[model samples]
Target: MALSGEDAGETIDIVEPAVRMGSYLAEVQPVEDAAGLIFLLWAIQQPTIARPNAFVRQSSMELRLDACGHQITIVQTPSSMSNPGVTGAVMWDSGIVLTKFLESAVDSGRLVLQGSKVVELGSGCGLVGCAAALLGARVVLTDLPDRLKLLKKNVEVNVKERNARGSAEVCELNWGDDLDAELTEPPPDFVVGSDVVYSEAAVVDLLSTLRQLSASCTTIFLAGELRNDAVLEYFLEAAMEDFLIGHVDQSQWHPDYRSQRVAILVLVKK
Candidate 1:
């Protein structure tokens, strides 16, 4: 079955019978009422037991950026849930929301990406980084060592193949580790991340890396799914020690992409 919406202007094919309705809902949570109802009705009609050989191991997600008028395709591994250690294998809603927010921010002249230097932390699937590059910012996509293979592939396919106005290079970045001179030579114009804050332990390291990457003029934009209030609060409290932090109101987000479960924050070093 296929589902499409006016706002999204894209058709999604429902092909995995083995997947439960809840699984589909989790994949596209915070969907509009119309789409949610459609998914519900479709789920009601599927058989209880999925047929054999129905699983698709890989998929591609497409994000169309209106600001740059480019369609970015990101290849994702379908078993992110099973491989919890490699959460970066798939694209998350927070990443999607952040990418669209960047596009909107650029279009409205609220943010300038053209010719700016950008660094993306935890660049899962390289979605946000590639979007920034397409918007004309030179970007470095950084993640843990294992995630680089897929991250590099997505960057190559979306940014390099398309010949984006700006450029993107994939690099390995472990939180709390010393950053290479090239990454912090003059400090980036912007440091962006999505879904990077998850655990209390990682918050300290994340902030350490953020401090290392930021300059007085650097702007940091982080988008995250509001799953754990305690963790988020911990990150916010720790982050405020060295930076002036503010939330990007939902009013400023892309209209169709707004979600109560997602938050975008703007930070700058003190």
Candidate 2:
């Protein structure tokens, strides 16, 4: 078969690996034999360029997780790598752990989800907030403006069909910004975030946002991946100055889903 519209000799030489292997044989070749070498080069080189892109175009995937006997369906981007800078694009292990913990807590009567006003910070994929809405809490899932689209889509798909007792809303919440006038009137009774403490620079802003929404009776739950020791340590140290922080034992979560790398911390306004 024809390799390129270009000359066969030039094409064969351009394929470095084929040329090296065929160099000795080429010395003995008649003019007609060059076409055989050209075909071999074509066969080897086509796959390298013809292969489809490994990363799929941006799209949402539906994932099913059973929490508190309720099957939660969350729609989110398949891979964070597909869209960088949007940590909120995918569901994380910390979010799963937190969601399971919330389900268990509500079922055991340790927490009151019913009628409680809840706000979630950096609600990546909106899994934790959707779980809260499933459990009967009036939930607001907040993220940076750029992240709101995916977060809202997840909330819509997961929370709407459940016919949940509580309603779910999506809003913009930039940590450290003045609490929006609407978010202030009825201060949230509970503040929750999953895997939100990834950056040292954002810790102060996160804490400020938490402090703004918190009152004496408000409780905050922050679930984070223990991947970075320094970042986690810095958050705890800085947050201790303003809030009483305590770790929730893994034993408190569903046995099957417990993980050493995931931590859920409860913070009360001090």
Q: Per-residue lDDT of 165-203 in model 2, one digit per residue for the tens?
A: 788999998999998866666888788998889989999
Q: TM-scores of the models, in the given order?
A: 0.76, 0.75
lDDT comparing candidate 1 with the true structure: 0.73
Model 1: clashing residue pairs? none
RMSD of each: 13.1, 21.4
Against the unseen true structure, what C-alpha lDDT does each candidate score? 0.73, 0.70
Best by lDDT: 1
Poorly placed runs, candidate 2 (over 4 Å): 1-60
Residue runs of model 1 more than 4 Å from their true location after superposition: 1-67
lDDT for residue 46 in candidate 2, whole number 0-100:
38
Tens-digit per-residue lDDT, 182-225, candidate 1 = 78987898999998999998999999999999987688888877
Cand. 1 TM to true fold: 0.76
